[model samples]
Target: MSKEITSRKDDYSQWYNDLIIKGGLADYSAVRGCMVIKPYGYALWENMRDVLDKMFKDTGHQNAYFPLFVPKSLFEKEEENAEGFAKECAVVTHYRLKVNPDKKGALMVDPESKLEEELIIRPTSEAIIWNTYKGWIQSYRDLPLLINQWANVVRWEMRTRLFLRTAEFLWQEGHTAHATAEEAVAETKQMLEVYADFAETYMAMPVIKGVKSANERFAGALDTYCIEAMMQDGKALQAGTSHFLGQNFAKAFDVKFSDKENKLDYVWATSWGVSTRLIGALVMAHSDDDGLILPPKLAPIQVVIVPIFKGEEQKKAIDEKVSVLVKELKQAGVKVKYDDSDNARPGWKFAEYELKGVPLRIGIGARDIQNNVVEVARRDTREKKSYPMEGLADSLVNLLNDIQQSIYNKAFNFREEHITPAETWDEFVKLLDEKAGFISAHWDGTGETEDKIKELTKATIRCIPLNNTKEEGKCILTGQPSNQRVLFARAY
Candidate 1:
């Protein structure tokens, strides 16, 4: 029954690692920079994936998978992208491995099995996907190709964390093609909004919708739109990103479409994605020292019914009541679990459910049943109240909705209070070091200045918020003329 989690205040990093392992989310794998997502963790990811899949379908995007390996030639087609990911690319040179002739029981790459051309495990799907698009598009009729792929990608990260950064991770990358730059830009912005909506509504994590500066923009993209969320440790997490490729991939792969006038033009393109790192974001944003605090909408088990009983007769009565309650709750479209197993005591089950971040817990006992009441516990506020069982299902639904909004509001308020505005260099550094949230400051609009600030403070510009007001002010670092302010923070 002990909550053996590291205190967040003492060490945020250890707290995160402890919560992931102790809460049964994920564990370190034999691979250097990869993780084994346990069933409980995978279940959470599945719920997130199902919701995002439905959202993409509703937005005119169809799910179609692409190859995981890209030929070296096709991958290097886009020079900027190739150079950007060159450091992290994992290449396959030999196709087969054989037992060593000299060293018994040891496997070695067979010299005769060398491939004609090397292959690049996909870091992103732009190159291979655009190569395929070359054959798919011929006329203006194929104007917009809204395609999304749910797949795993490799990026050979040296410094790895459970769900945050790993060598290989699962993600959904959306690659779309358009006939016009305008349409492609619109699509990029649309997907950004979708991501923001999902983060705020489903994950109960508030985010700021913004555009990345040139230095922070994605490789081969003209503009990168992103949603940034502030974690409990006062750091920024890039929750999701949408890139406006602006025909970079199209031109590289010779993906052209003939207009009605018979003139061929390079097709415009966009790519946006959200990875399992979001699971880390959710944990950091609202989780307490006790354990995770998953939002109701995203939790695999929204409500868990834990029955309290004594002997055979009381246990039978509690089991019967739990069955009826479970049926009623499921009928009302609620994800509920009846944990009647006696492997653990009631107290142990309560602690386990809390660690798992189940939004609500209902404890029904023989005494409560006789009194026509049940004890309901809220994870977010850690509040418990007894209510009659007559209209329990409906009341629980409403309570879940309230908890969702409450969690969002709490995160929103934290972000609001933490964004400190700085007008001078001294103030910027002081706020970044002392108060560690977001620094809203004017920049000289140069990558050199941004790089200098990052070098000094370890804080980068999180984003230049979309629709940010244009005000005449001096750059906080350079004392040069500036128009609008950008957000800066140390990020994950």
Candidate 2:
């Protein structure tokens, strides 16, 4: 490797920071808590968005846009949500900037231009979206209005990382209105499964599908379903969340629909979202100390062909072979890049692409061209194999798929190995401090115990496994009788 990254074992956070900048993904912006996602990073986001947008459309959701700023009055309508997000909101008090009369070469907020009510930049679109849904949903026929919006949201965070917890990030929030509670809950879980499938199949990150506890639920939601993925550092990241909002938003906004009998009732609601945070999850889940290791399905450039030459004749010959190979790969629906740039050496190109996480790399040198073979390298394992040009396209496709499956399997196995069941409080605390993965411990099903555990260990109950067994035991902390074990981990 020409340039090495901060090893994950040395410092997990440092490794993540190094990977994002070194991999050509993103960089910190001038603004505090914000980032500038570069072309490669944006391309990865586009791929994720395109696939998810299709999934939503196929499932009967239509795209819509909502205002970025919410009136403070409208935001306060939902008391619980307002309280939950109050500390993290960016408020605009004035609309104009004026030249500072007391200072040279400076501008400041015009005190005279302050509005009657402050505008809160949306941390989420629920308030503004629900207020608009009030008018669109006046009858039973409009009860199930499925809408999704792809937008950037701002959350004023005290500390920020690139995609994980940036002040501004891109995400898709799906807000739907349903007539019945059962239908709304079902929609919530359905979208959770969609996120899980996308993460596992496309991003090659395995996730656990479960429900959030009351204390961990979405601000205004009745219940929250989530897909939690374990990062390589053994910390849990909530990859995505689907909220069964019940009638909270509708009630807050007075959004009502008439039933078959002509009785007016509030609409049941569901809101689900997956953000650029998934990009962070992808980085930590499979990337190695070498650099990023993008899954083939989501890699912006799935395969790159680097042609090597020592002379003009050799260059001509290699270019000819590369052109043919590129055509074949394109015909097979593979995204291929032929890198014959004279500015960079073969060794430099190899290190660059490895950092950028290209799944497959093909090197065609003068000697290899003579042998009618090209050296192919796998990003995941760094395994190199020389294969004859014949049937190379088909082999590349298979190898890409194999790499995808291999990454998922590796993550799945690692997650399984890290999940340790603890029967005693000492063991539970010890595991949280030492191993630090998913700790399955009986919780007496009390929010007080949950809060105490979180206070002491900085670990929350991530979820109660979907099909958890009813094993009679004592609460790891409270000593109260418990029926089942819940997964507890310090999460991102």
Candidate 3:
């Protein structure tokens, strides 16, 4: 199985790269900063996407798609958003490419086909969606247009990883139009809660629900709510974000609706999204040096059964019993696999499944069949146990549930232990020099102070936290009077 992954302790960064490449999750593509997600990895993503799709639908949001390209004029309508993404925007200057006249078999951009107006590949969909909303809304009845789009966006990132950051990536963006500021704000907070719930419940990763600092807010948003999770290395990852756009987009695009009083006003807006970067977060938070530690709820294969038999006479008997057990497990709503092929040894399959992070593994043999029992192994704690075949399916289901909880508990404990607080500038610098996980320290609540701290430490304020307690103290950096503490960490 060649499970030669680098030790996380030796080099966390290389360890992550080794896991992604050798674990069969993804591979580098011909493109410099893009990757090809393997079937194993794509299956993981499909499971995550399925759960999130249902969650969005249950919350009264409908899926609808918009254009991938935004006209340069429309994108510039919102000054802040345009300026924020301008550096990463990919532009289409010409319509077609022609064979080079000077060099045969080479293609060149056709100057004659240059477009009158350039189309910008969307870094985010806010500009194009809001422009279309101008035509979709005519009255109050059209308010609260809850639309979600599942698509890929390009950000032109210079440094790229398999899933964390790339030149292009897949994500779901929710852009909604609201009738009032209160509703928009409420929607933003609600989505943040949904993201936090999904992260903790399905990903088996705990997160901090908080409000982004002004300097950290979304480009055109008045307020940005986020769920931040800590990886095993003590770095923060922004799992998801929901922004209260306040009337900025609506005013920029002139999307107005008439109220019951017959007065017209701009619509309130919100945008929230979670990307495939989440896959990276899940891997970093749990997995060991051997392989991935996928949560049962999101694992494509929950349980896999491997047969340990010598010959056809013994294998046939074991197969008969294993087939029935497989059906029972599936009927019980378990994702189970029975590996009956002779192409590889049971040892190889075991290592492979362990590397894939299958929640549970079952081994059945001729003697075990005669004894009416099978051996089961738990991936999280690597504990092995024997159970009777009579109710093995039911017992395995319960075991999977426990594994999910156990993973979350371990991660939560790690996160709690890493969150260190510092009162003075010297202590803050020392703590961040170690960069255990998070630094909760008082800030003067000014962008200048935030920028200075980041410049000196390369650690930005992750968030202010929701419902944060107020306390009088001096700022860690400026020594100015402060009221509340903010979370500081180097983030992905």
Tell how far residue 351 is off in model 3, in angstroms: 0.8
Taking all chains together, the TM-score of candidate 2 against the true structure is 0.98
lDDT of 2 by residue, 1-492 (tens): 367788998999999999999898999889999999999999999999999999999889999999999999999999999999999999988999999999999999998899999999999989999999988998998868999999999999998988999999999999999999999988998899899999999999989899889999999999999988999989999999999999998999999999999999999999999999999999999999989999999999999999888989999999988888899999999999998889999999999999999999999998998899999999999999999999999999999999999999999999999999999989988898899589988999889999999999999999877768889999999899999988999998
> Which pairs in model 2 have colliding backbones?
none
Error of 1 at 226 (Å): 0.3
TM-score of each: 0.99, 0.98, 0.98
* lDDT (Cα, tens digit) per residue for candidate 3, span 366-428: 879889999999999999999999889889999999999999999999999999989999999
The Cα RMSD of model 3 versus the native structure comes to 1.0
List the global CA lDDT of all models. Answer: 0.94, 0.93, 0.93
Best by lDDT: 1
What's the best-to-worst order under lDDT? 1, 2, 3
Expressed as tens digits, the lDDT of each residue in 61-86 for candidate 1 is 99998999999999999999999999
lDDT of 2 at 232: 90
